[model samples]
Target: MDAETNQSRQSALGDLALVVGTLVAVKQSVLPFTIVYAGPVSTFSAMIVATFLLYRRGLNWAALGLRKPDSWWRTLGLCVVVFLAFVGAAAGFGAIADIFFEDVGASGRFDFVKGNLPGYLLIMALVWTHGSFFEELLFRAFVITKASTVLGGGRGATLAAVLLAAVFFGYRHYYYQGMHGALVTGGIGLVFGLIYIWFGKRNIWPLVLVHGLVNSISQTQRFLGA
Candidate 1:
């Protein structure tokens, strides 16, 4: 292989390692350290490692699909579409899970926000940063891009990358959301992945907006006891 191909593979391998390391750390410490703390800690740590890796290649966050959109209005429209699709997907998947599982429990971690003004406010305050931006950056952009590259970079590889990333994204929530939640979230991830590519992989703003909307609605429902 040429030097360029070799370097690309090596970088992809580094990204894989980064992802695995972060997941391991989160999984190991989540129970004892708590996701509230462990989540951000692992996320930022992975961000740091990712940044360093990008620096080595003289790239930036933009390389991980954070480019400016061609049209703001188009992105906004896409966000609305994606948000509705997510709601439908979640409901459909939840129904499917119900057929097999007796109790598909919710994520208990956010239970403290239910009917609690301060907790709700705090979570809402960090919703964009913690729930939307970072999650998309890690699970969608970073994982899909690197995974596709690692899989040798083709149309089929990209689809497989999306599937793999979606599964991992779902697994990340299993610690708190149980199997049902994981499956639902995984379905959501698949939607996000497909849209991420369909809307143009270079721009992630639409996905971020959609994710923020989902989190905001969920948080509001919890706050209002819905």
Candidate 2:
């Protein structure tokens, strides 16, 4: 195939895979299963399909922005910035959500960890694997890359992709968190998405680290009842 034709074919496959993954997520969310099981089912199902699609195009996780950074120090610095941005965004959006709701809805899902050392420890173990790594891979890496490509691969496309992915990311939390949680989480997603584009979309390690840090802190707060 010619270059243009090959590119077109790849785009088509990406679109298909994106749609399939999204549908799977939506279906899983509404199923009778609990969030603990449903969340992983949706995430892993989408990830498996995404991986298969990428392999068909001779691409892999690296193509979805999973590569290592050139400098650990620089990446660590970026992680700090992203983490601060996450806090700012969460607080800002949370304030806005408070205006419409009595309080910004907290996910009761994590209440099990409140003042429970064992529960906190259990979730902390999964924070890196399920929360940080896979979530970023699916949301930031896969969603933004495929969305940007489908939208025509430019700055505007990337921004739009970020917004679209942020909304989806936020909605995924809606099963456990109400609209307030979705809004706050969505804002955080926007921050992460923008940072992914700003850093040239070559490395997701920084975001992954920041994500883990955020989850860890949140879990710790629950453990301490802070």
Best by TM-score: 1
- Per-residue alpha-carbon lDDT of candidate 2 for residues 2-117, written as tens digits (9 for 90 to 100): 68856864785466567546646555764675655566656667777777777877999887678866888998887888878888998999899888755434556778888888
Model 2, which residues run further than 4 Å from truth? 1-31
Please list the C-alpha lDDT of all candidates, in the order they appear: 0.80, 0.79
- What candidate 1 gets wrong by more than 4 Å, as runs, is 1-3
What TM-score, over all chains together, does every model reach? 0.91, 0.87
RMSD of every prediction: 1.9, 2.8
lDDT for model 1, please.
Answer: 0.80
Tens digits of per-residue lDDT, candidate 1, 1-226, equal 7899878978897877887687567556765857555666666667777777777778787876688878889888877888788888889888886777545465567888888999988888778876788788878887888888888888999999999989988887777778888888898899889887786367789888888888899889988988
| Count of steric clashes across candidates, in order | 0, 0
